[model samples]
Target: MATKSNSTKTSSSKKGKMNLKDIPFSKERLIELFRQMLLGRRFEEKCGQQYQMKKFSGFCHLYIGQEAVAVGSIAALEIGKDYVFTTYRDHVHALILGISAKEVMAELFMKRTGSSHGKGGSMHFYNGKTRFMGGNGIVGGHTPLATGAAFASKYRGDGAVALCYMGDAAVNQGTFHESLNMAGLWGLPIVYIVENNIYGMGTSTERSCAQPELWKRTGDAYNIPGRQVNGMDMLEVYEATRQAVEDARNGQPVFLEMLCYRYRGHSMSDPATTYRTKDEVGQWRMKDPIERLKEQFPTVFTESMVKDMEEEIKQEVADSIKFAEDSELPELSDIWTDVCVDYPGYPGREASDNKYEFPYEQLENAKK
Candidate 1:
């Protein structure tokens, strides 16, 4: 696969603009990046089709326009070494991490064959082999968990790093600060990536954030190194993420904010818009990342090649949906099977579940 990243792999300027001239690695690599991106787009469209047929019936956050970050970061990462955790918009990361489309589709269908065995639906994807953490649903709760994962990596003296992904809305939460402080103070090997999509669930950036220059957020006592990149550009994201991961492995944690946009609503449940204007959306549509990259990448591939790639991705996505549709749903018996470790006598047969209540009470009791 062509590397196709925009990263210079050199020290960035203080403002953190990546030198993208070094990203396009090889023809094969560019095509690979293009294929992965097409797959992500097709997956979202397939999800919409499945949902319309009632095969998937929960909160589904599609990764239609947000493919570059996942593809870029995952390209820079190793399956077993680096860990990735992200918000509910995580199918792209899971897909990039080698989770089977059959299992992912089955999970969306609420079948026992799901990656999380039907327990973790669209928002709770998991795969142990790839080291992807979860499709966390809480607003900003997963930041500390990312820190802890890096802390664990450090504790084991493994050079592995943790890649924490979240959105612009999440940066406003207290955990974002707390986790950054802990990671910087203790020097955890973590890359805090904020996918700034410009809108956080209908809220404008300036209206919600006190200071929307989100990359500069690492300036507090923790002194985390921060950078801003063009998220829509895979090369830009790849360049920024490569350095950030390298810096983390060297004991300097990095915070990165990428400016991007979502082409759709918050989820399948939400109408396309209640906050932003169509004119604004159309303006962004002019800068379509996929189209721009298709031209930028292939010296030989043509418009027909682009069309052929689209067709191939659509076929794969269609097959994935069929696999999910034909797949069976989790049995009622499966409902009780994954409750707890003691739910079964066998040591390895144990399963995990979403805690019944917020774990605060349990934490308070333990403190007492």
Candidate 2:
């Protein structure tokens, strides 16, 4: 059994300190950990810089500080069997699911070679091969779709799972409750992840949710089990997700509400500094999931570990831009090529009739 770790805060007013003594900690794993967070953070940072330069445009929600939720949760899933679905803050999630940074960047650049054929941009991302279910721009709309996917897994007896994630504010929507009730009743093979980032747009969670224990949003309505976990610590997020995954595999759909905070605004347009105090951001910065882990592991680690990570990630980010820029855009005919399939005047067409592709554009608009 993995030893349970409880986080402790630096201040007495804080909850608990960060600890990861139980899990097998290794330099390689830690390096990979740093890589994931660094990649996500650097990618988001680059997107912002690019947006300013007009190299990339259109709705971009940077996931600068929320890397832990994507990386840790992804570590718990078996790719090709599990599905990744989330709200508009989705680039990191898609990347963690193995979407190439180059393709993601190309999409951001609106080049036809990128994911969604350059349709998704920064907020909407998807890759069928990676089992990434794409990002939903709607507030709480994807909840039902994820639930339906989970229900499909069970219906097919595929031993698969679906992870549905949403913001703390999305809980206020009617679909959130409707899906929770459905999942609870049917015992779907899904893990409900409530990313309680403390605020929804300009509104704080406290002001937005009358009961800020937003994880318990549907506690009274359904008997589905749920728990609150610290979202800032990667290992803590990994462990909780592991437990929830196992339970869901064993016929119990678990709801995990990770108490997280975004260091940036809701999107590129919204100014996060307005609602959140710098002191609050500073406190959370000290408890950075990557920094906290570096402090915990190798017993006697040095400064080089952090510096080397930065250097390596910087080069990697540079290479990613090169790759995306070098990648060729889709041919003009590709627009209609992927549109619809013909009868082909061949047999077995009836056997392939069950396939369906998401109408990404229409869905994105309807969501807002």
Candidate 3:
């Protein structure tokens, strides 16, 4: 068993004690992390604008304030060799995994060029080749799926780890417990990340959970190593995830609770201000992940460079929108095409003529 690491906090609050030189990442890597976080924020901002303009038909969840949690955590993974999963707020995860902004935008616009061929909307963006398992709609539903992936990796000795991202509220679901039990028992290489943004759709964690410190609660339950990091601080998130990933790859299950916040509402439909105060939101804005990173390395990210990066990101976002708009929608007949296949002597549903009724309905005395 891997020795459990102590709960850690490496946020900006310790700025006086820790300087930029104290951090381990290289200048280039730090810049890349900032770019990734900025890109996710920009992409989601575009998504929110499109949702308001009715360019997309389904639900949209913006990962505005939680960029660090996705970018920092994913940076630790060996892409293509490892796997990733998340809930509906998954645009950031997909973008971080090397999926083009155009592919995700096209998916939102229901264009045939989308990752899911425009079939799976915002919530169901998938790319099996990239190993990003995509998002799920149900609360805590994907937990088991991630655990199963870890099981397969261990069985095949693939040396792969599964990174599962879930919200704070999802920890209460039964699948969370069941999956953790199985992972702990089998020593599967999986890490359960709870993006604890405090509010589970307007209700604060204190009101909903008995123990608000989720890192401790879930960790103690399954005896899996866990850590709580300031999600708003990208460096802290990166460091914590690096350790967790190391433990997981060595056949030890891990849990992580990212103490973060979301600037927007649960979904595009919600206003997000009725339950929380504007002052509270303002406080978090002061700790914006992008700004915090820039502050830590002022020399690396000068004002002029920051401005240039902003302009570059804006142009990239514009191009993605244009690409999605120019793309065509899926043909009506294509609807069930990618779903499955039919074979000789084992025809698919449409190819079969047999009809059947329920066993209870087949009884002569049963009511229609």
Candidate 4:
């Protein structure tokens, strides 16, 4: 499979902006990027379909238009060596980070086969084995966690870097400032990326932010270098993030603001049209990132090749859905498992001698 990301390899940048001819990557590599991006798009489209069918309950956020930012930026970091943290909008991030579509779909279906054993649901996705630290539901809740992950790396004398992803709305939270201040003061290896998708839920960036240029203002406050890039352009996002990851590896923290937009509402519930206009949405659709990349490889990505890739993505999604459906639901007794609680003198004779055993049938009524 073309799952290996080109961003894993290092590439030196030239003085000016990059074009298709000057992207410093091979045709196969570019096509792979396109393929992964299409996979993410199709995965989210399936999510939307399942949500409408009520396959699962609870809030669902789709990363429909922001595929370039997630795929391109993630491609720059080392898979296991580097860590990624994000907010509630994390399905695409999980997919790009090598989490199988089957596992992610299982999570959406709340099956026992999910990454978090079907417990975390759509918002709280945890896969510590891959160092993807899971997604936090609260705004700016995971910034300090990202900072701590970076601190642990530096403390252990490892060269790992933490990539903290947040939406534009989270920049205003107190943890954002506190985490950045510590990261800058301690020189932690972390890259803070703001996915500035123009809207914070229903409000526009212009209306919600006192300083609209998040990369500049936020970075300047912490004495960190920052850059704003065209998030819609996958190549631009890749290059910018690659450099930022390099800087972090060299013991420097950096910030980035990606100017992108979401095609769907903030969540499944929000219609997304009440605050924004249809004309504005159509204008952004015109700049569809996948179509733009396809234009760059008209000869290489012939009609047949593009069709094959699309069909492959469709089948991949279908397989994932079947996997989720086939998976069994968690047993009732599962509630008592995987829960970490501290008991006084645990693992000692004092605790063991004090333990009481109750019959499974009477357990519920024996609470008193």
Candidate 5:
């Protein structure tokens, strides 16, 4: 399945004056993109608030400054047909990939109404209907799963592509390299995107990765073509991902390094000020993805329209919080469900029958 190498290209600059008619997307489509990014931003903000209030108990990673990477890349794929796999910093990706804000929030809340039915909390959101594989917790762990998905697509001859997203740190993981090797060898239809936000959990990429230039990391070893895109600019992300998706669909595996930023700390626990300076953070904020999009097309995004969108997103976030609050927690029996296929002697089957015989005597004894 080895395919010919495709040349890596950078995103075209949208500098100088550009008319509304000259924009690639239609007016309604651009507005939709803006709304999605805004929704992601607002939803994550509410998540931060809830985590601080002790609404959920787990490691919570917020996607504050990296909206464009998820929204723009996903906007290029055929949703429900192509598959998506993201890292633990996954709320925004889940929302962008068609998992409802309500379901995602419910997952964060650890309620049964969550995408994972409460079993998988904030870091493992899954929805088969939307082809969202999961919000995997282990760094670079899900890359192989995404690769396998692409292999399946190739085996079935389905023109579907797998978009695997990871943090800058995950690129150094052994699984990341292994997955890329297999994808490159098999010519799988997969796009590996590294959201190079400059840090891998407080350790800056420069201090961590031997080659901080992540896009250049793939070509020599795996024969995979890589491109770096301005992840702060939504249009640039979309355009770059669109081309990558096209190449991937043709059995040409591609790699994209999105130059984005995460305003929040690695997780809820870190204040993010100890390592990076406030001035550095402020500089990145100046190039916020949402603001960049609006500035690029001022004629398209009117002040009133932007206000209405913000208000609408505010209500939506409120509704999601309410939905999460009202949802029920998973039952004790749910622990055994969704674990294995039904068989005559399987633990889940026996548990379902109330036999409750298992190696973990504590749980079985408790049932008795």
Candidate 6:
């Protein structure tokens, strides 16, 4: 097991000390991390704007303040070789994992060019080539799927590791426990990350969980080593993930609780203010991940460099919106496509002789 760092601060009160010399990444890599976080921040901000303009429908959860949790941890992994699974608040993760911004935005617009081909909107972005498993909707549902991915890697003797991300609320679900038990028992190469932003929907962790110190939740039961890191600090998230990934590759499963916060509501329909105070939100915002990175490395992230990056990101996001707007929606025939894999000797291997019909049309005819 990787030794825990005494310097890892769980709360925003201390704003843990970050030494530039301690960061394993080069200066250029540090700048790249900043850019990734900035891109995520800008992209999510645009998503909120588009949602308000009614450009897309359905539940839209923003990873507004939690940019570091995705950017930092992903930076530690070998992208195409390793696998990643995240919850519905997943646009940022998709972007960081090399899913083109245009494809992700198009997915949000429900266009045919989406990662999931307009069928799996908002909470279902997928990229098989990159091995980004999915943007799963159910609270704790994807845990088992991630465990299976780790099992596959171990079965194949592949050195790849699987990283599963979830919210604080998901810890209470039975699947979370079941999946971890399997991983621990089988020594699967996986890392279970809980983005404990203190709230599960409108309910705070104190109310929803009997023990809110989430990092400690998995260790005793599963024999998996668990650690809490300042998710707001990208470097800390990266370092911890790097060690955990090493351990996972050696057939040891680990649990990480990223102490972070989301600036947006649970979904687009939620106002978020009903449950939390403006003062509390402000405090977390002061410890914003993007700003914290800038403060930690002023020499690397100069004002001009940051301004240039922001402008470039701004245009990139704008182009993505244009691409989504110009792209066509999925063809009506697409409804029957990609639903299931077909193979020889399968029950429905032959094409249907009957013409395809829309289900809603049938319902309308029945009403008549």
The best candidate in terms of TM-score: 5
Which regions of candidate 3 deviate over 4 angstroms?
A: 1-21, 343-368
Considering TM-score, which of the candidate structures 3 and 4 is the better prediction for this target?
3
The whole-model C-alpha lDDT of candidate 4 against the native structure comes to 0.84
Candidate 4, residues 85-153, lDDT tens digits: the string is 999999989887778999999999999999878888899887776789877899899999999999999
lDDT of 4 at 236: 75
Which portions of model 2 miss their true places by more than 4 Å?
A: 1-21, 24-27, 298-301, 328-334, 342-368
Answer with 3 or 4, whichever has the higher lDDT. 3
Against the unseen true structure, what C-alpha lDDT does each candidate score? 0.79, 0.77, 0.85, 0.84, 0.88, 0.88
Cα error of candidate 6 at position 302, Å: 1.3
Clashing pairs in 2: 7-16, 7-17, 8-16, 8-17, 9-16, 9-17
Clashing pairs in 6: none
lDDT preference between candidates 1 and 6, better one: 6
Q: State, as a TM-score between 0 and 1, how close model 2 is to the true structure.
A: 0.84
**Candidate 3 lDDT tens digits, 162-212:** 999999999889999999989988889998999999998988899999888
TM-score of 3: 0.90
Number of colliding residue pairs in each model: 7, 6, 0, 0, 0, 0
TM-score of each: 0.86, 0.84, 0.90, 0.87, 0.91, 0.90
lDDT of 1 by residue, 25-93 (tens): 766777788788888878888887778778768899888777887888777776788899999998888
In angstroms, give how far residue 39 of model 6 lies from its true place: 0.6
Tens-digit lDDT string for candidate 2 (1-368)? 11111211211122334334456456566567668887898888987887788877788888877788888888889988898789989988877777888778888887777887876677789878878887899999999999999999999989888999998888899998889889878888889898888888988888977777765655445656767878887777887888888878766777888877788888888877778899998888877866665665645234876678778778877777777777776765454444447524233433455334556899999999
The TM-score obtained by model 1 is 0.86
Q: Give the least accurate 10-residue stretch of model 3, judged by summed lDDT.
A: 9-18
